[model samples]
Target: MASVQHPFPPLLSQDSADIERWLLALNDVYASDEVALIRKACEFAAPLYHDEVDVTGASLLQHALGSASILIGLHMDHETIAATALHAVPNHLQDWREVLTTRFGANVTRLVAGISDMERLRHFSELREAAIADKQEAAQQVEGLRKMLLAMVEDIRVVLIKLAERTQTLRNLSSASPDTQQHIAQETRSIFGPLANRLGVWQLKWELEDLSLRYLEPLLYKKVAKLLDERRVDREKYIADIVAQLQSALAAQGIKGEVNGRPKHIHSIINKMKRKQMEFSELYDIRAVRVQVKDVENCYAALSVVHELWPAIHSEFDDYIANPKPNGYQSLHTAVLGPRDLAVEVQIRTPQMHHDSELGVAAHWRYKENKQSESGFDEKIAWLRQILAWKAELADSGEMKEQFKNELLQDRVYVFTPQGKVIDLPKGATPVDFAYVVHTDLGHRTRGAKLDGSIAPLNTKLQTGQRVEILTAKQGGPSRDWLSPKLGFLQSARSRAKVRHWFSEQNVDDSIAQGRALLDRELVRVGVTDINQEKLAQKLKFNKLDDLLASLGRGEITPRRVSLAIGQEAPVNAPRASTQTIATSDGNVVIEGVGNLVSRTAKCCSPTKGDEIIGYVTRDRGITIHRRDCPFMQRVPEEREDRLLEARWVAKTN
Candidate 1:
């Protein structure tokens, strides 16, 4: 296949070369049909984005190609590659979805949509200084932010595409301003680099780290780069010579193995120096070669060959394969005296181990991104990797889409406070829930909210990466209406519980005042007036008036019973009798001074048989019974205590 030249602008013209090079690269890695789909997508996108430019002032078409190139290097599937090509086109063309579906089919369209959604992470880009200034907290927050990104996308491939795009952006970052470079570099280091690392995309992960280091510490980067370049050719020659000798020895020993020099990147070298507080001369791995064999046995055999070829440094040998790291990294490492007494490190492992070390279980990114594994985010990434491994066999488009929907990125939404601190919440959580999640005091005082600088309803469901600002009163508690499910003001159960607890702790005076207001409202609704308070309170078993009012305020007693007990006409079809007294239910009660005046029990306090009971003569509906110590009875006025009637349960009544 002929190499396809970079397709320059004046796009959609006849002279543009076909992207056969990219297609050929995908041929062996993907099914013929999947490869064809990717070609169709690339051809469709090339013309549409040809005239565009990206944030770094590069051709948007070239940027897309660069991003697709990164995914291809990861050996990603057709959907990911195709989506990378088309992720930017929708921004330029109207009805892009219809166009995508008509040309590349629905699967590609869906992939494009997922990629688009994942790309919208600008709020994370603007985190407050407080969030990142503290090392430990920043690491935790960054880990959470990575999980948030992973959890936000419907398909794991969307994140893969995003990482690819970020890699390309950083690759061409020199075209951007110093400010843009620093900003982009910081974002990659804090978020995308670690994300790539966790996903085991070692190729992108290392480059991201190296590039970020380049921009973040320019002087150190230049110094190290200059030093490495000074003897680059000599180092390469020496490494090549060592690899040749190792490869020849392994073959002669009937051991099939691959040997290569592991160039110590500037960033990694500097990190080790600073971390270990060592001088450049003290670094044994400055010159290193890795040997990858077929199995564990072959790994030891290869290590023997390396030892026989050079004198091993006793202090530098580590048999990690026998005792793996906590994250499951496996290898045999040793430093040896090489040609001219130069120190060179050798790492021996199986090919599988090597791959794992690069982008598998042993990759450094996995441990960094998931040091705190309480969230099981590491397991999610592992599952995603498993899914990607079978991408070629995932022939059922509908099933794949459903799997994408059912799993990955659905549990938590990462939103931002106005101060830029990230606040994580369950999906479909409301702004009031967000307020409560931030602080209990904030939740209690939360009266209004501002979402993205616009005043929003308290119940508005928060989306990932939306900036939220809660408007609170100087002092107040949550409304009782917030506890009402039908009102839909709050969604978080924690917030609801907090509100309930606040109300439960309210002062008795306040409860009584509120309870009185509710009782007055109920009286007006029932048209009851001039009631004998003492008799009512005594009949209800309350020794104090305020106690009865407090119970009413707390909803321990319903207002309907107050009307019925006082002999006011009940609401139409309302229950005419209260169940508070056993005598009313059994028709066995005797009220002194009231003879068969339509007796009933008060529902507020259900007085049982053998209990001390009292009664109040209603205006018309006979005497109502109550427990002697009921809170309602205490509300009765002393002057009106005459209306209190003695009632008892008759043992013989059936």
Candidate 2:
């Protein structure tokens, strides 16, 4: 028998030096025990990932190490690093869960599980890209997917790990096939890059964007790169000279600050060029420097020194410190004419502002999302970003772990359609609610649903990340049971309203039919079968025949009244009800042929003044008045009809 070929690539030989270097990179931040735990995780993953290569044709172990390194650059905690190292364990090891939990601990296991859960979304991302034809629709789907990714994980660190893994994959994407490269690059640019930007992980965000652009728009990427390289040496020299000049000026003024040249990213350059429709040379921020001060006072002092050193471009200044960006980014941005009359952009801010702009929820998310106000979810995201910003400082206190597990956006659940589109709903939303959200027609025809490939009840509370496939009929309407509050069929108000509207429409049609039947019977009995219904409806003060019929069917109009309106004498055989009217002295209800009896508005219907009312005689409580059209009143049994009495509201005299 021939040897069976495995679907995956052969495992590459292990390298001990690679493991040593990875641990060495973390030695400064992690204590010895923590480092040892991370080392053990790497060692455990090494043999398991033996010879198996990822899509990029890199060994799984190398890929894991690369991802871990990215997270380390983000200053993530030890558990995040370890989880990154073991992210692929579930794919290679069946007992991975128990093994990871037993050896590495529960937190690491949970993080690995989260990574694995997120990995499943890759196929959906591809599907979404292929399914959406409209650019605007595709953009909306991408935004939903980004939120879904965040809402899916309990630990925000899992998202950081996922971002790190994507960054690493892009780093080694050159080895992949052309088609694979394009797909990966596009996904990174659309999804992961924005996620990184939102998390304020500028370290990974910049690399992700630059690398993705390098593949997605190769020609443009090279053009920007070449333009920057052509002036690389000169720009570096110019920025360095400006930085030294600013440092000297600030020092001379006795203001303590640190000045450094800021590297311009190719993607951002391209973005600005396209956004402002300006050439690379016209961009003011291409050769930029940042000044970090100790306090707000020092920030203004540094800004003053920079402006005094170079003539300021009044139009190019932004006082973000006083009026910060929506994402909590605070900095003073200004453009000044530097040496040789070159435009030099400078940003001045305190250290805290600098940290926030780089590692907190800065302007990147708002810039990409293009949303003006912060939603509840965005508020929670801000909290998550704060945790990341404080992770390093809180690492020794062990509070980072607790903070990492704090679930956010729990009020919303994000589910996927069969076609891979993400649908966001309120938490506890059911499959029926999902259907309604997708389309009202779909919701009306929805008969069953399959959640994650298995049949689930229509009322099954959908969870985040589940792929829901609604089984719809060819022709149908929604069920009344969906409107029942106790059934849990719908949790969203929008969906519930849709179901109610469907039923109300059906009821209106039925009422019209019933009204027509009753009116026809009355017309025949009164010997006026030849009368025109349209004219009769107009005589009865109804704008439409259907409206007249609906009123009659709903018992809002009596057959005797219709006969009288049509100029027919009442038949002696017809039941003779009291026609007496009683006016109350206090502008309260007046029951015909009844007086001196206590009456109270029914709480169920709350019939108020000016409402057509009916008195339902209770045993102890004199009479419970209800609206004539109230649902409960309509359902009153025939045996109780004798106890009911005609009632009307009498307006008070001025």
Candidate 3:
């Protein structure tokens, strides 16, 4: 056979190289009339292949083609890719419409225009704030736009492909500046990543998380990467040896099984360290091995073989073959001493179980992963998709990707209840959290708990497979003690809010009653009786007298304080002083002997001249006349009460 060779040019000299490649690939599938369209599309995409502008990077063509591969893998068509490449075509320095229309006909032009409008969104802050303030409106807008795009062209392939192109451009622009990287990653994490994850596009979701994590927490990302990289060779070797030993042991026991291994991701290892407060050296279960076999009989046979080969750790042995997690995770897990006495964990399951283990959450997402399994979780998982969808789409949107990333990166522990029901929680979940998960009533009344038939505190952190039994009382409710900053937050937001709600309702009632009494006393001090005050308050536009009373009752105003308040506002000519002298009532004043000043009363106090009088001689001013009974005169008393003379006021000023 003769070999045919095609000539290719280096990127340095290849003019229209990308367009040429696209046409060649398109030529394979299309007929003559369609081939004419492919040539036209090449002419349209030609400018993007230029050496200096869009073609600045040698990798540009590869990135665009790679993005196209992702779209095609996701089930997109040529029309979609054609629209997508046009979508990324920049028109910042030129009239974008004329350029787009001049190249591809209006179909590609219109789709690109819609994406361009969304990207050209002005006042990013205001739009973000509005979305936050009115989530329903924002949700409506999201669905509306999505529907519009779908309705405009019944081909969703085009928009997805365009979005994929945008994602690639973002990845390219990331290296330009840290700020650019951060902005692009934030957009992807907030918007694109969640959208992709919801649609079950895990390949895109994972790349987006890693890229976002790289820029968002660069140090953390690098630390994790470095830690993983450092341990990579040893980890690979350890798991490989463990798997090899397990398979050999199983084969010798006449049990056929397939063995494989997986190492924990860096994020998961870091999380376990943070959660359990352990040094990196103390991490257990960092590497795990799986033995997949024929049936439940072989599964146990493999387990027995594993146990015989290595000394089994009784405490770490998990018999999920008998009881599986609620999420349908089923397997026989056991930790044992492998070659050289190294601690190695082994999991035994059937081929069906092996598939379930890999496709845990995807059992419901893509229907293909939903095969019949020993664990009955696939049915329950379908129900969770709606709940998880909101979590991905709405509730705290910017954190959606981070939360998803963390959930993936964090470790899980499976626990159990007295009745053999399985409960899966985060590694450090406590009994109170479990109590809440059981029932709201039980959570509120939970005073203590019993773990594995032994008494434990409500805050006791549950270990995997430990049976929890909560102790409650008829009269008891949640203690303030349960809301511990140290123990852990009961992760159920409903549970936490219910506990707070009980305390808040009590405080509100107490404050209202206490405020009323304090304010009522204030109004009584003033001679404006409660009845008269009602009339005054009505004139003041209070809906009812209690409103005025309550306002006063609340210490917001005082009756004595009101006197000073009213007096300060009155005119100078008004009778500002009260008619009666406002002092402790008694006619007799305590004063000493001084008759001359008592005979002619002092004008200052309006004291009667003949009234009980006393003389208070002033500095360099003699014999200021006053009634002895006057309060100020009485304040500085003289020798005899009998000699204290009275003074009467003479109308001097008038």
Over 360-422, each residue of candidate 3 has an lDDT whose tens digit, in order, gives 343232212233333444444332222222222243365664553345212444455665444
Q: For candidate 1, what is the lDDT?
A: 0.70
Assess candidate 3 and give its TM-score to the true structure.
Answer: 0.39
* Residue runs of model 3 more than 4 Å from their true location after superposition: 1-15, 18-43, 48-63, 72-80, 89-174, 249-279, 282-285, 288-654
TM-score of each: 0.64, 0.71, 0.39
For candidate 1, write residues 15-97 as lDDT tens digits: 24535554676666667787777778778877887677887887777677777776665555566678787898778788989
Sort order, TM-score high to low: 2, 1, 3
lDDT of 3: 0.53
Model 1 bad stretches (over 4 Å) = 1-15, 18-35, 127-144, 231-255, 300-343, 356-411, 418-420, 426-428, 439-441, 448-463, 467-475, 481-505, 512-654
lDDT-superior candidate, 2 or 3: 2
Clash count per candidate: 21, 3, 19
List of clashing residue pairs for candidate 2: 10-51, 11-51, 12-51
Task: Estimate every model's Cα lDDT from 0 to 1.
Answer: 0.70, 0.75, 0.53
Residue 138 lDDT, candidate 1, scale 0-100: 72
| Candidates' RMSD to native | 13.0, 12.2, 27.4
Cα lDDT of model 2 by residue, 112-166, tens digit: 9998888887667777778778998987777677767777777677887888788
Q: Indicate which candidate wins on lDDT.
A: 2
